[model samples]
Target: MGMTEKQLKSSNKPDKEMPLVQYENVTKKFGDVEVLKGLDLEIKQGEKVALIGPSGSGKTTIIRMLMTLEKPSGGVISLNGEPLWHKKIGDKLVPADEKHLRKLRSDIGMVFQHFNLFPHMTILRNVTEAPIHVLGLSKEEANERAVDMLNKVGLGDKLDAYPEQLSGGQKQRVAIARAVVMHPKVMLFDEVTSALDPELVGEVLQVIRDLAKETDMAMILVTHEMDFARDIADRVVFLHNGQIEEEGHPEDIFETPESERLQGFLSRFLNT
Candidate 1:
């Protein structure tokens, strides 16, 4: 069935409004380089977004900010209509303390390209560690949830395996399972398939496709996979020189790009 059909069937949940995430006039800089320039974006709940652009266009940076890994140099970000960088109290933006950020983070998840699994831990342990340490889930509960997640990602039999025993694609899938175990409302994927071998890329992409189909969690992906982005994303955001050059439905962006920079960038990909 189409996404719209599925959306209609799952309409009983509390009204989670659109624009689950918002960046208003956001900017970021690295000394002499301005990575983000007055960027503004609104991402709705359950929207699957693919951010694409030339290298160093700040696609990854945007994900980092959403993950709270990098603070924005200017402007504000909000998640579920609450300030991500600050807490509002009586009309004033107070500095958001770590505790506050931690609470807010329960609604977000991130999966990076380089599967950041603990080398020493078994796959099951790696998956359960966060729930045990951060969310305070009991060992039994965490294990059950971890096993379910691993199975969901097609890693059920590999629970006893360590990171060293898994292939790159397997490791990436495990990382994805780990992130989703928390049932985050928003999932950030930063070039998750970029490091995979060409032959192995499909396995990882398939896993991600399952995730998109199974959950209502919103996802924002930074990726170079143009075809997949076009097929899956509800909207495609193209960043160039740290700014959003153009953004639209995949057909419009890829088939009839209005921006000169976008056309030039796509041309390079075509030549390759």
Candidate 2:
């Protein structure tokens, strides 16, 4: 299905009603180079947005910012209508203190391009460790939750295996299980399947597809997998040179691109 008229019109502005995530006039700069420029985007509750573009188009930066791994140089980012990287103190807004930032960021989870697993920990331990320590769950409780998540990701049988014993695909599945055990309100995926072998990519994608089908978490995917993006995303955002150049339903963006830049970008993949 396509975006409603209201959603399309509000694409450049924050929905006053509060989306699950909102970026208003956000900019990011490093030294003299700007990576994102006045970018405004919103993801509604349960919506899945796929960001696609050429390298350095700032797609990954958006997810990194949402994950609180990077901060915007300008503009305000809000999650659930609350400030994310900044806080309002009386009449002025200031950078959020570490404690405030952590509280706000706890609602979000991210899985990266690499399978950043702890080699020394077993799959079960790797998945349970965060919840046991960060969320204050008891070890038994964490392990139970971890087992269920691993089962969902098709890794239940590998719980006792260390990261080094698993294949790259299996490692990524464990990573997904680890993130899901947090029960995040929003999930950020950065080129999640990019590092897998052609045969192994499907297993990882299937786990993500299951999440999209079974959960209500707002998902933002930064990926080069055009076909997967078309199949899984509710909306496709084509970013160009640090701005959202075009966005629409996957069918519209992939089959009937309205911008030459987007058409050119897709042509590279379509022709292959």
Candidate 3:
């Protein structure tokens, strides 16, 4: 892991820069069930990755941890080389406060599978609300940014529409627009397209592909779309039973997976 410019600038020490995101010896448990087992991962800036595996294999868990919606039971995580849970105060690693957590989360955006939009707010409001409330942008400034993002997602004309008024694909796009308007450095998608109708999946994937090509923001997507993972991900990780069974370039994971577990998993999905 390496340090980002933002982290470096915040530190007085020249040698303390850290990786964009790092999980070292991380573990998560739910009573008797261990969801992650001493997992270690390092994602540099601008990497596009897809996580795939069988059901209950901890793909979504990984994404949630990155979003800090779930804390690790053990180990440490860092973003941009700075500790997300531990901050350096006079050379001491002290526990982080809620204020720091909120700031840390501002750099990460998440798109849930359910498209969690405000039904009462119009499409524009749904996208603009966070920027106004969380980022402290003025209403007009937030609206302008929201409209531009909506236009980017090809929903310019639907600003006045409600989430219920739009199709499944449209709602997902608006959800995406809401996520990106904050200009997050890392976007975590937890099966963003899984809930959509078969026909609506393509539109969401196309927008994602466009974003992948146009931005330097890193993306970690948990998806069941095998073909999209094969084609769009710079790297693909396959998890099984709370561990990463295989990880490599898309072609390597798809055409030449190194693990029997991955081979079996893909065979079922590919042949389905």
Best candidate according to lDDT: 2
Q: Taking the tens digit of each residue's C-alpha lDDT, what string does model 3 give over 43-156?
A: 668778899999888889888988988887877788987778777899887878888888788889999999988999999999999999989999999999999889999999
TM-score of each model, paired residue for residue: 0.92, 0.94, 0.91
Off by more than 4 A, model 1: 1-18
Estimate the Cα RMSD of every predicted model relative to the unseen true structure: 5.7, 3.3, 5.6
In model 2, the clashing pairs are none
Question: Candidate 1 residues 12-113, lDDT tens each?
Answer: 345456569988888999888899998888778898999999999999999899899999888888998899999888999987999889988999999998
Per-residue error (Å), model 2, residue 254:
0.9
Model 2 vs truth, CA RMSD: 3.3
Best by TM-score: 2
- Candidate 1 lDDT score at position 90: 92
Task: Give the lDDT ranking, best first.
Answer: 2, 1, 3
Better of 2 and 3 by TM-score: 2
| Model 2 C-alpha lDDT per residue in residues 111-167, reported as the tens digit of each score | 989989998999999999999999999999999999999998888999889999999
lDDT value for model 1 = 0.89
**Model 2: how far residue 84 lies from native, Å:** 0.8
